[model samples]
Target: MKRISLFLLVIASLFSTKTVFSQLILGPDTLCIGNELQLSTTVTNASTYYWGFCSAYLKNLPAGSSIAAGTGLAGPSSIAMAKDGNHYFVYVVNATAPRNVIRYEFGTSLSNVPLATDLGNFAGSIPVNPKGFELVNTGGNWYGFLTGGATSITSDIIRFDFGNSLSNTPTIVDLGGLVLNPQDLYVFKEANNWYALTNNGFSGNLIRLEFGNSLTNTTPNVVDLGNPGSLSDPSGMWPVFDGTDWHLFLVNRGTDRLTRLDFGTSLLNPAVDNDLGNPSGLLNQPRDISVIRDCGSYYGYITNENSNTMTLLTFNGAVTALPIASDLGNFAGFNGPRYLTRFLRDKDNVFAYTTNNADNSISRLEYNTCSNAAPPISTLQTPPPVTYATPGLYNVYFASDEGLPTMQVDCKLIRVLPHPIIEVNNDTLICQGDTILLVANGPGLFSNLWDPVYNTIAPYDTTSIFIYPKEDYRYNVHLEFTQGGGCAYDTSVFVRVSRITADAGEDRL
Candidate 1:
């Protein structure tokens, strides 16, 4: 009897240990198209890491199956998908001396028994301790900026000219002091020039560098977007253009919060769009942010380093001033997730990938909250095959797994061309010697443009005019519809002028 009890106790202890160690970690995956989904994860601990591919869409990830991309990876840091969508170049960094990169053909493994053409040593001649890097193509030339240096002097941004083929042999030009202790780098286009933006972790300020044509031998403008809070160690910056202006979203690791800056006329002076203050919920060590605009709504994904989780938020361009973040629950196997990026286009669905530093794995997630959820409560009945009938505005709420409250997403509907019906006082007969008031009305019309200029209030105002004529004439008024719809509608009325005769006395007549 005692032996039986001892065995049961041992089994219970093992179960408890497994539960404590298990975690929810998410990772980023490279995009591979064609029905099946493929992903590559870099496990830093093991020299031989597996690159896995899932066989189902993101929503079916919980039940999907994945296979190894290959073995023999030295813990890669970042991946840059080729413009062709057929090749992927990965930055592999291990505890070794120099950081390295390998190019993998689509649907091929890095550890194919007989490897073909190894693109070796990603960190060629660029000092140690690599942070983050971005590659961009401009005017037929591929350029890359790598952020790395010594611990205290890690503010150097290395520029690599990969030529036409993006060869591993790069012409290096070190642009030092672009940002004080830069952590991550992002590249974007404005007007005719290209700009590089970085987060200075040490100085707690967001910096921007502009370069045209060539990053080498050219002096770039450096602008400092001062951090509002005290310990705002800014990490990641993402920007989106909303017709009129650019909205820049930033993640501050020191402050543990998300803030936005708006650039009206210039990137120099930025106004705070939304300041959630310090100690925002579940933002512990927020590292990277990415935005996916789907179905007239912007979905923002953020990775938190300390919490080992990812958060989702919604930003409606027309409605809200700032984005409302919702905890979309945690990825089951992710640990210390770092980078978040949107994967290949899947119609209206949002599929995202993240990279986990703690476990060195990649995760795929599907967000159907805004796309799949039922349209908010509406009174109007939708026509056949249509979900919502009303064409105004709607709202959606997302609940995050973390302590963050439910976030709302706003949606709007605008009809392209609405057939407007015009109504005017029918064929009126008036004496030309006297002035008369004529009014035109059209429901659901935006503006009106009338022909034959008469006494009017405004040229584009609702048609209300007064006219007088000396002879019998036809009065025509051309009706113009608002909302930039189709053609114009016209109607005419007749006015007859009469001669008034006065008879004094009939005797001499």
Candidate 2:
């Protein structure tokens, strides 16, 4: 009987080893929209190797470096970026005097200067300061929500309807009052219900607002989530869903420690605080944090107020108490870094920014995501590139080691971007020796190249150019957006020159 049991255990061990060793690797998980994926796998020479993209697995944390984001920002506290079908808008709260919200609009890509527009103060003017802010886009419309902090008395949360543009006078609604000062607020949607969660710094209670199915719901179901975990001065928090359950990791400014809470599946339910004692890098008052999940791991960047530094904490899963902390050190401090935000433009392109409240400047961290990349391709020959007309998230999948029961499989999500349409003049008849302007105009910025250089005007490379043509010319223009991921388009124009004939009917006499 002992020999039989040992044989079974040995066989089970071998199978486990096979499952781990044959596990396929298809990575650089995050991709810029419209970029062609050069996919291939390591298990080569198999009868067949198949692959695609869908839900994926990630292993390690990516590395990043910090710098200050440009100038012209004043007392900016919280920042959030939302993508409309055609463009991206960044909203920042000017938490100081003459308090108002600043919008930075970028088109197609984040390569150029963004247009900054100040959308007046909260309704009834600015009384109390603006707290945690978030922007969410549902259907085709954009919505901006700002939390009001308590000064001498309780304040109400406000919502703004941006329609399609954040520039117009927003339709604002005061969402009622709370007893304590509100801290960091987060807004998200699940199923048909839209929800916003905000915790008060003074009351130590987490508040939730349910907007139901409508983005414009004025009367939200407000609930005071009395602090469940002895959470003192609750401030910065980040949530993650690991296939089955939803977990929240937040910092308690009052206790100078870290706490984890299990919210079962939905964040709507009350979260049971799971305390994770103090780690070394938490520093003095950990104010705000942002979390990113890929390959089954969570990477969170936290801002410590008193020490004026940033710390990088990682976890194996959402509910784990063992958070590995690494103090990224201070970024030329004394400039109290208050809140932090991150934008993963794509794999190989990641950036995080911290709003320095003291000096009124923003510090940016650029991460290197290109290390240990092994993208798997099923078909030995890479498939011809695909062009997605509209922009959104898409599923990709791949399979390998065909004809075997233990074939390897992997999947991930891919984003598609909109096409950059080149606007120019149509076929036209021009008088001989006359000059005409050729223009390719659009929003954002682009690189334009005009072919048939002969007879073309000076300033050959630009969005709009003048042409002094002596002959009928067919000009083809190739355009590429300053937006990365190889987003490009081409179009052409023909110019007909009408010349007056000064010759006899027959050959010259």
Candidate 3:
């Protein structure tokens, strides 16, 4: 009995060793909105989906990041933020009918109260297994490609073009029989040529596809990159241009590993490298992955299905040969997260979302403290327009009195223009043992000062100074102002000495 119990424990440990990750597939031309991070997630086999809004200010606290508010959807699989900041499109796959495309408009706030509208299906034909898809622009028009279903019967790669809004039913062009059982698709452009990439789950291959001038082309030149790094069950794929060549990264569900495939210049030839090999037993069936460029660095976020965790990966360049991966542990109410998407524009207030199939819920995750904590309102008028008195070239930062996360903090480089121009009177001649008054003139002059300190009734307020010199000497004085924190000043003026000679011996007086 003791031996049997030990055997059971060992088997359980092996099964739990693997976790899942996510790939946040976004539509083409989607950009990060202003000041806030918006995330939309889909829950599979569930009746409803979810979306959340978080402040971009919480960029520092990745773990402590929380959703400000969230709203549920009827059902959706893929989501796209429109070129217009106010609208969003989502692909809703229905088993009974052709997939339905829906549009949502954001309200005054990130409230889930989206005004929903239906945009019909792909040529009125519902593919059996619809999975990964992306929005692409071709020949001054918008198009979308969806991959999934069987080999060819239902497994066709369907292309849909939107005339104006997604409201009209799109014209469908099939590209499945050639690629075979494609699970996901991503489209990119190089020079003048347009290319499409997809992963065939059954064959374990990444296929490179090219279109001849038009995205509506039925037959495209296909290049099959057979399993890089001997990848097993390639679930998610993302390619990045590293200012040089395009490098592809994918997660293998069977091996619990992430690998990199490099295609130099052209996709015809390729090389493969292992990014993160299963060590410390962290990666357990990673399902999806997404990459965003921030501050000259590439950040990769993955969703773990079995472990209900998210992994963060960082690369030095746009595309990295090796990356550092860290596990973000588990979040509250996250179950079997499958898909993820990130706001790409601002890395400071980074935001990403995941779809949990097990619990039929969406998990929204944000990084940084600005997004996690509310913008603190100071009791005192913060960012008090304190004049930058002395200025050359300076980067100024404004903060609240408490030094907490607040909207007042604006760290920016500012060139404070030189103070109002000022001029002092020219050199003057004064006899020995005589007093000379110095004067200065300038615009916006509130006060003046005499340098080489001389006795004056009102040194700070008076514009003139009286200097008594016993011998032949030069007197210098400068004018100062109270504004600009007393830093604004005028050039110094000098008083020349005049000599007087006395001749008593010559006259016998």
Model 2 stretches astray by more than 4 angstroms: 1-72, 111-113, 122-127, 151-154, 165-169, 317-321, 331-334, 369-509
Whole-model lDDT, model 1: 0.47
**TM of each candidate vs. truth:** 0.53, 0.60, 0.57
Candidate 1, 144-232: lDDT as tens digits: 66676535565467776877545455677777756667766667555656676676777767667877644454478888766644437
* Residue 465, model 1, lDDT: 64
Per-model RMSD to reference: 20.7, 21.9, 17.3
Q: For residues 1-509, could you state the per-residue lDDT of candidate 2 as single tens digits?
A: 00000111211211111122233444333333445544445656566554433212223233433333443567777766644434555666667866666667666544335677767665555436565666555564556676666753646677777776555566776665643577767676778787777787786788887889885787878788788866788777666656567776778888878777788878877788877766774657887777665333466667788888777777765436487888777743426777665443321334455667787765655543221123422255233343333365544444454325444544455554555555788888776766778887666545778886667766666887777567888887767665443555667788888787443243211
What TM-score does model 2 achieve against the real structure? Answer: 0.60
For lDDT, the strongest prediction is 2
The worst-scoring run of ten residues by lDDT in candidate 1 lies at 1-10
As a whole number from 0 to 100, the lDDT of residue 149 in candidate 3 is 71
Candidate 1 TM-score, true structure as reference: 0.53
Full-model lDDT, candidate 2: 0.59
Error of 3 at 147 (Å): 0.4
lDDT-sorted candidate list, best first: 2, 3, 1
